[model samples]
Target: MVALIATAFVQTGFAQHDHATHQTQSSALLPLYYNIKDALVVGNASLAAAKAGEFVEALKNADAKIVTGANRDGLLEHSGKIAGSKDLKSQREHFAGLSTDMIALAKGSKLSTEPVYQMYCPMKKTSWLSSEKTVKNPYYGSAMLTCGKVVETIK
Candidate 1:
């Protein structure tokens, strides 16, 4: 996933975008991943060195899962994308866990999480991605995570 995310980052220069369903398990949905990866590029401007590395690592892992297609308990291994028709549990878990992590990061940054929000819903049984959101991620020292959504899935 790190490879895919890194590749996307290299090409897009730090913006999140759907690079077509790479794995057989993918989504036709608008891949709206948190734009916080750009924040990771902030390069210790606000976050500590360790924190920055941790953030990057977390993002890389998530991206890797999406690209590689893990399993039922995994992100990209088994069968699921933003709009996956199966494995919604892991998808939701992935984003929810990410949300939890982001919230904690925001708290540490002395940001107001109250204004922060995330949209996650199941589509049948597959993956669940973010969509049409307007929450500012005060944690990344920027409002990068203000919009997102996953839209399609393979049956």
Candidate 2:
């Protein structure tokens, strides 16, 4: 009975460690996501595509337990679309979907140590995440720069 108890304790400890590790890995994806968003904000489709490709590689490297099901599928799908396209319009279109999934992921997980702002574009009717409170609308770039407002702050 004592041996069984020890085994159970060890198992519980390992489970907790796995969960903590998963959270850390999930948080690591934020920088990669931001890279793509920053590229879009600058109106650089090629850079955005390159960043999307890098984000995809980061996701692929993440532990399988970090993201699962629809979350994983959506991230891969949207980022892959952006990575494959060189056209700014096409990349931005895919970015909306990618941002949606990213927002969901950010909301569902403790993805950052600092507050993350969720900014909304009234014109595009879409939202994206940012490490800062100030909005640099990725949807419209400089055409309508500062077009969005901070809709939520994920702490």
Candidate 3:
């Protein structure tokens, strides 16, 4: 009985350690994600595309244990689309999908020490993750810069 209890405790410790490692690994993607979002907010298609490409590479290089298979694939697909396109419209469209997957992932896992805001744009009918509480619409850029509201905050 003592041996069994010892084994269980050891397993629990490993589980906790794995979870902490996963959180750290997952949080690494947030900066890259923010880079793409910032590029979009400025209406810079070339920069957005470049950032998206970097994001794709980061996603691919991320620890596989950090994200579920479906979520990772969704991220890869949307970011890949954005990376392959230089048109602002196309990049923004793909960003919507990428944001969806990112929001889901961020919601499930602790992505940062600070609160991460999930903003919603009624005009675009889409949501995105932001490190800031202030709204800066990436979909319409400066045209509707402050067009969204914080729908949720992931701490």
Candidate 4:
């Protein structure tokens, strides 16, 4: 009878421990998801603007995403490109190829394992602003891709 009591106690303790671990991991991941979504929205706008040659509209798209708090799609990440306005019809035709590459990056294995931008190339003026890009996407200097992982969690 004593042995039975001890065994049950051990089982109870283990179950509680497992629950706590699961909760911890789930909680840790929530912030990552939110951060990734926000970055994608911002990055997408830049991509769109680069193609359209309208930097202002790209910024607007990014701002809109940040303000709307839309997280319906489960955090798209991967070095993806949202869409940019291509000024030339011939060059615009090249974007379809870009879509394939963007999709692959969006669904990359590191979407959760690592950061979309795990580098540290800060702006020349501010040491605290990572909200913008460091190196222009060479393809379009006006288009930026600076958002990164969630450094801090909300709750």
- Assess every candidate by TM-score: 0.23, 0.89, 0.86, 0.29
Give the residue spans of candidate 3 off by over 4 A. Answer: 1-21
Total clashing residue pairs per candidate? 17, 0, 0, 10
Q: Which 10 consecutive residues of model 2 have the lowest summed lDDT?
A: 60-69
| Candidate 4 residue spans exceeding 4 A from truth | 44-155
Residue-wise C-alpha lDDT for candidate 1, range 1-155, written one tens digit per residue: 99998897788853323433222122211122233222222322222223333433443444343433222133222112322322333433434444444433333332221233333333222222222243332232232343333432111
The 0-to-1 C-alpha lDDT of every candidate, in the order given, reads: 0.32, 0.91, 0.92, 0.32
- On residues 1-155, what C-alpha lDDT tens digit does candidate 3 reach at each position? 99999999999999999888777778888988999999999999899889999888878877887777999999999999988998999999999999999998998888899999999999999999999999999999999999999999899
Best by TM-score: 2
Model 1 lDDT, residue 28, Cα: 16
Better of 2 and 3 by TM-score: 2
Please give the distance, in angstroms, between residue 21's alpha carbon in candidate 1 and its true position after superposition: 32
Model 4 residue 107 distance off true place after TM-score fit, in angstroms: 23
Residues 55-112, model 4: lDDT tens digits: 2232233322221222212112111222333233222233333323323323332223
Off by over 4 Å in 2: 1-13
Q: List the residue pairs that clash in candidate 2.
A: none
Residue-level error in angstroms, candidate 2, position 47: 1.3
